[model samples]
Target: MRTTPTAHPNTELLVYGIREIVDVANKIKGLDPALELTWENIGDPVAKGWSVPQFLKEILTEEIHRADNRSFAYTHSRGNIETRKWAVTYAKQFCPSSTLDYEDILFTNGLGSGIAMLYQMVAPGKRILQPSPTYPTHASFESFCSGNAPIFYKLDPEKGWAPDIADIEAQLQNHPDIVGITVINPNNPTGTIYSQETLEAITRLAEKYNVMIISDEIYFRMVFPGHTHVHMAELAHARVPLIVLRGLSKDIPWPGGRCGWLEFHNTDLDPAFKDYCEAVKKRVLLEVCASTLPQMVIPTVYNHPQFNAWNQQYSTELQTVADSIADTLNQIPELTVNKTLGAFYLMPRFKQGSLNNRQTLPITNPQVKAYIEQAVATPNLADDKRFTYYILANTGIVCVPASDFFSPYPGFRLTTLSRNPEERKKTYERFAEATKAYLGSG
Candidate 1:
């Protein structure tokens, strides 16, 4: 009984690449206070100089001082019933083809919590087929639950990061244990929006395989001028179950809020799916409820007269930044840059064989250089990660390696959330220079 306790094998599968790279940058900063770190690793808009809208802040302020004190109370396990009812009405525009009910909306601390719980609830030996270059949270949790590496269907960068239908179908055919397929529209890392045709094709495949569809639509409202976000619920067949995950964290630009919810679509089509939804609810019951104040302000925030204008303005600004960054990165012949259509990220990939372990960026600080050299020297270190550390030490720009997203390609993901135009211009130039130098060294 007193024998040494060991961590679960599943625990080793969990990795949040964004935060990990930040840790590396922090250590480098410690070694060199003059490093002047530019944080491009994480997707926190507020940290990147985005201000919360005054109207939304005023709504939260009003909710906080309500005489009823409802904001402080624990809501129903599923979430605030009235807020869920309002959500049902609001979500209908995106999922016009699917039937939705108030009872179907289940709120969580954030989508991160819900994503982890969803995978954890899966029966052993079953897997959710995730997209390659996935948001790390989904990949890590799904991998942990399966007790192995996650199964991935490629998102073809050559095709604007659209899901490869043939690859997906092949994976489903090869692995009968895949219980569902997850889609991130206006996808992370690669910010391309899925076309309606691509989504419909995936839906048809899911229908053919009888696998549920999990759509992460956190950035659905953040689409740029030319792109459209097609909700999976709209394309999924009636007999195929769907779970649409939405949250206030991204579009609302409120990472501190930590509020998100899941909408169960087509649950009525299958008793097992209904039971799975119930299991998710039961798990939430153990936690009482998500934050009550954020849930309370959902309707007020959405109904505000200035909300749509604010979101549109933000999207336009994001498109501008994406274009600027992509333009800079594209100039480097060693990289492939895709202009982001939605979301606040740009993933510039290295050309095949462009990055090798021998490549490096010159670091002036002796301490920082040694730290980065040792980090990169770790056995079996991915080339993208090695490049990430070198860039961090050389230019103080922190980006998560695309390989950390389980991408087949070697590259890195950086956020386009910086609000300062001059600062962004300088950062992009420095990043491009560093990338060129790194690749040339090889």
Candidate 2:
């Protein structure tokens, strides 16, 4: 039947940046499954051969039996009240000045859900201000909710991927409609840690502009030595309204838990923010509350005495990995790798004028070369993404284009999550070789 297609105005088929690029890469793929492929694209630590300690695994096992049928039952819409109280006590350890209580905490499926809830609260035509080179999930959610793309302030790559205070001030001063600012400490894709001074400046800006602060501190405890993660709630001090989102996925060393929560700060200082908090809780009820079993494990998992010990040990080793990658990639001459100070990712930026539109990586296989040629024929993909596709085909190395973080930075993010020391060194060496060869081709 040659009937006209029906219109669906209210529907959306949404895709975030990472998956979207990976899809394009897959569509143009020409390689066979002849070799093991390395995934440097996704940020799952456990997937890369990192394992939780035996003691932690036992905690889970014991909790399941001890929790009884309650663990299997649905929790309150705001999550198990007892768990909420425990999370507040835990979060308060970092921000002792915080007055947040059980009522101020709300659980979500993950930090991602918490983000979606917050974005949905943005009034029509109003939006949140995000840092450039942001994690795509947050960026896409803000875009989806506002019906308009959010504006990004600069995170200066020249300055160790630090937030540009002047740029932030200019953005706030220029755009009065920006209701809040979002920051990811131990920033993804770049792994740059924000200094206490930098954080304070941001806090002062939020307070001065009378805007809310939305912080994603998912990597709070993943910091290396000489650097510490500060809770925005610590600096905020109830002066400026704030909401800090964190999760068990990273620190609990458990990604599949699907457990994360938000802590509201200084909401009573602003009537609108207070209302927003109430709205977020009601919104979670719409989802019938995040999965219950993971909520059951939080109090037990966090309060364990040795939790901080192993975590610090892990952090120290992670610092070693970061330094190794920075030193290796920095030696490439064609690359400038940022020394990762917190998270387990490293962003090696291409030196100025290192890549051009017509540049490409070598593809010995004619079919693969043709596939990439076709994929990059138009000005559709970012230059770094084109490099990603070529690198995938040529070396079986998968990585995300760093500029995809939306900072105009020419690079890609690689992780230090590889558990084997020998394999980690070889991987970075191969990466360096590929990058140098790729840049040399231009």
Candidate 3:
């Protein structure tokens, strides 16, 4: 039994990287049953007590009752015909001059898959650019598929996490290997919506470099007051090759649907790009198709009269929640909260030099304390991780560290989705208490 371990013969080249977001989420999920998990890690709305609107739910119910919808069947690998047409029409309603055809649209399990397929066609060593403090799935997928980590430009924290246009231009000028740019509007973790000027400037840069624009607009309908979600297709550039990814996951609050689509804007611009899309469609066709039930319901739910009203009321309420949480966190001098323009996340930055290795939240249980100590010993420990581990051990609160969000800062991302008013207040109060304790000890 003392023999040396044998090495595996082979593995997929793409399996080298890890998705820290989901890995950490699984660890939090496996916590002791006695603990109350606050679940501020994942961006799932239904998990936070936001229900699907009655009108949308009715469509699902009707679909279930219909005999024709029962079988699990294959669709066009490109997606259902009706859904693709509806999505095109949906885009045109916003971008009247936008040039996209049904052939350009491709459906996958979700945007996660769509991204992988898109990156697959890109030649190795050619990088896709994104911003720092990014969603791990985007950056990680690019790395996995292309065998290169993403080429990223800086998003200035002092400037409210906006992408530095000059840095972007400089990067593209210096690095001619970059073939595409990724933009996440109403970004995850930070919730900083890209300004219209920023969007246009990015488009111009993409055009200047002759690279495509990969815009992730999944939060398209989750906009709050004073901020609007602008689709890249709607930009005045009707000929800039762009791949816009979107779905019903966020707005409809139906993440389990396993349905999302990619709209290829300006596919005609590059013949090679057109061929790349065709290759992806061929790969998709091999899978029979994406989930059909969701595809079938897309036109129905989107065209319903109630969708707009529900989104307006829902976003208005979400704005209040985002504001309250930001204001509360800002009151704590130890934490700096950002303006959450659209999504339900607020990232509180821990003041520099405020945390130390020895700082901890008050913990009573010996077992939990031991676990926290082990988790905190890892390399590149940030102040946010210190605060997060302490809070988890002491208050039974589970949150994703900003380190997981790919930021150098030491702070955690807190959600504004605690639906119960009194319970929500208690959660914030406990967080503030834990933060104060950690900072005080330091």
Model 3, span 290-407: residue lDDT tens: 8888998889888899988888888888887778777777888977888788877777787887777878776565666666777788876776766777777677677777776667
Q: Which ranking of candidates, highest lDDT first?
A: 1, 2, 3
Show where candidate 1 strays beyond 4 Å.
none
Tens-place lDDT digits, model 1, residues 400-430: 9999999999999989887899999999899
Clashing pairs in 1: none
Q: Among all windows of ten consecutive residues in candidate 3, which has the lowest summed lDDT?
A: 10-19
Q: Any idea what lDDT model 1 has?
A: 0.89
Using TM-score as the yardstick, the better of models 1 and 2 is: 1
Which candidate, 1 or 3, has the higher TM-score? 1
Candidate 3 local Cα displacement, residue 122, angstroms:
1.8
